[model samples]
Target chain A: MAARKPVFNQQVLYDTTPLPDSIPKVKELGATSAPLFSASFFIGTRCKDYNDDYMQCKTENPGKGEFECLKEGRRVTRCARSVIKDLNTSCLEQFRAHWECLDDNNHQLWQCRPAEWNLNRCAFEKLGLEKVIPDQPPQSTPVHLRKKMIFAHYPIPSHAKPFITGQEEAKPKAS
Target chain B: MPQDMPPVGGYEAVQYKRNIPARGFRAGYYLAGAGAIMAYGWYHLIVGLRERNELAREKMWGRIHLIPALQAEEDRDLVRRHLADQAREKALLGENIKVYHSDRYVRPTFAATPGSTTK
Candidate 1:
């Protein structure tokens, strides 16, 4: 039997920027050609921080201790956890990689490179930074949106869990 | 009209007669509700069986894949014995349902079509 081929469209890689007047950029780091695994495989089934509507993190469960950010003047926590159970191994790896890239990019764009402020400004403007990052980081997005972003870059393997539930009680028992 | 109307006793009789049909309708509604519950139970049973079968299939796949490493080069007899035990266990479980036939006829059955957008 012939193997099933991967499916891709424009929507696969880039998300429509919610901000007005901007082109979508490669927000996700890893790219794949596989389908997402089942939700049953994800770690956290019902994470408290997940915001279903905007697909972003909520402030419910902050990873970091509560602190005010200089850039946004809002109390924030570094915690962002996934809600899916037993996410596919491959997808999980890719997700971590993509996240690392985003973190690195954020450091370089915002904090590290003081000399390239103008270039960073232009890059941020072109990438629609004003729109993507809110004035005061309204709330952190849930992990699902991050997973969707990861899937956009990489072909999600079949049955990739959307989020990893960080809580122990939420984890699925091995049957 | 009071003069022509039936007595109070007759009024009670008329009311009793009117309630008979309503009582019958209530009984019928309860019976239909009971039947619907039974049908839903049967549907769940079928789904559970299918899931069990799929789990079993996965187990068998795992056992077969693990056999090569578990039984090394010099253990041909042990490998044969292990395979036989697995086959015996599978046979003991027997066929839960007609899986192949059901898959073939699934389209015509009540099951939803593939990629069906209907909730």
Candidate 2:
């Protein structure tokens, strides 16, 4: 069989789109929580890593059998698996509860709101994520509308504020 | 001749040799069996090695991620500080920075024109 083209040679990096608000935002907790949105992300990223390793191995050892490149490929795969397993182990209880609730509620966000909140709360407290604060008090509105409006008006937390504020503090113009 | 009668001259007894040569047949069977066993063993050896490598990689990566979970409060705090520093440095460098375009706002390029297709 003709040698297959290496995946890395194709400039298609894995999708970097942020997870939709509908799915849980566990990764927002930074490196402490799951590195990516879903367990599948872990698998995909790891697969990419494995492919990279395999390609590198092939380039270095042309005409070698699959067994020759197995060493590096396995290393990458193991690393990815471990990262996923760690995340699961760390937050399995909350993750399970959130998923089960979604399953039970037919994936209706409004119905699973409580479970979602519970999971977020657990992640925030345990994973060192920045807590988002609303700019104004919540208004009396439909649950879905309220959620949308709340996020719309949410301001960055002080701890997580960006270093660059376009308006520099008035320091007398540097002489 | 009556239907049930034996050949008229005599009941001549004839013998036939074995259809297959026993020596060759036995040798072929033995070779085939050995080949099959070797193939099976080779297949399993490859699979076992693959599995072992996977397990090892998993363990290695797991420990890296697990560090945060297993750290003491002070260590965790240090990690958080390190991350904040990294973010600040990146912002300062401003490498490959892209302008943020909010979905709420429509740019001329995005606006639909008469007789034009919307993307």
Candidate 3:
């Protein structure tokens, strides 16, 4: 494996302008891509309604959504930041390990399964965030829970217990 | 002048030997071997491609599963920045003046701003 160079996102565009005094202040998420990807599903679970609402607002507002949907958009940002903050406080070790692994492996999650497994368990136990792939076949095993990853360069079978239980692939019932 | 007749001792027993009948397998056997190897290589190539495609699908879906949340997060940031810009304009100009002629909520851009001329 040709080792990839560590690429941390150092360039952040800072808007010097301030929000109107009327708008409530909320800090933007500081977590970059790898960390965000690591905690993405948790963010989805915790902030799904806010996210969907924001998206719906945008769709409804059409060309005016950017300004018109500011309220919903703020909700999305606050919720995601809170999820990241919770991850930092509760599962910092596993979270760091997973995101660092993701960073190292060009953000291919399968390559960092063991670290991800640790983080997922921590998140589910401590934060109630589950990594559920919506609309995937119910009978099939999830990629995250697989015993083996065929494409991984260094396939280490994770021995960690699943955060969510009873993923035993069920047979199709004869209707 | 004598039609180039052999001169000495019948030219050392005609000085020539046959091609030794190509001491190897016949053309049919060689073709069969080559065909078998090609077939095996093609089979492996197909299998390899299938495996690669499956991996690609897995990778794609993995990202797909996270896109909604990521987009929402990104959209939120843009909204915040634009709102901040609106506030700054109201503070400085006493009201939010329209950048464009018709009102449309454009994603945040400094293109219309004087800052575009600066670094």
For this target, which candidate reaches the highest DockQ against the unseen true structure? 3
Mark the regions of model 3 whose C-alpha exceeds 4 Å error after superposition: A1-15, A158-164, A167-175, B1-101, B107-119
Q: Model 2, A23-81: lDDT tens per residue?
A: 22222223323233223223333344554555566567544413344445445445545
RMSD of each: 28.2, 27.7, 8.2
TM-score for candidate 2, residues paired by index: 0.23
Candidate 2 residue runs with Cα over 4 Å from true position: A1-37, A43-51, A55-65, A98-175, B1-119
lDDT top scorer:
3
What does the lDDT read for residue B20 in candidate 1?
A: 42
> What C-alpha lDDT, on a 0 to 100 scale, does residue A29 get in candidate 1?
10
- Best first by DockQ, ranked: 3, 1, 2
- CA shift of B19, model 1, Å: 9.1
Q: Which pairs of residues have clashing backbones in candidate 3?
A: none
Give per-residue CA lDDT, model 1, range B5-104, as digits (tens): 7776675534545444344457778899999999999898885564444434433432332222121211222222333344544677763334453322
lDDT by residue (tens digit), candidate 2, B22-97 = 4555777889999999999999888556444443443344344333222222222232333344454577886523
Runs with alpha carbons beyond 4 Å of true place in candidate 1 = A1-175, B1-24, B73-119
* TM-score, per-candidate, Cα-based: 0.22, 0.23, 0.65
In order, the TM-score of chain B in each prediction is 0.40, 0.35, 0.70
Worst 10 residues of 2 chain B by lDDT: B104-113
lDDT of 1 by residue, A115-158 (tens): 12222232223321111211222354422223223213244344
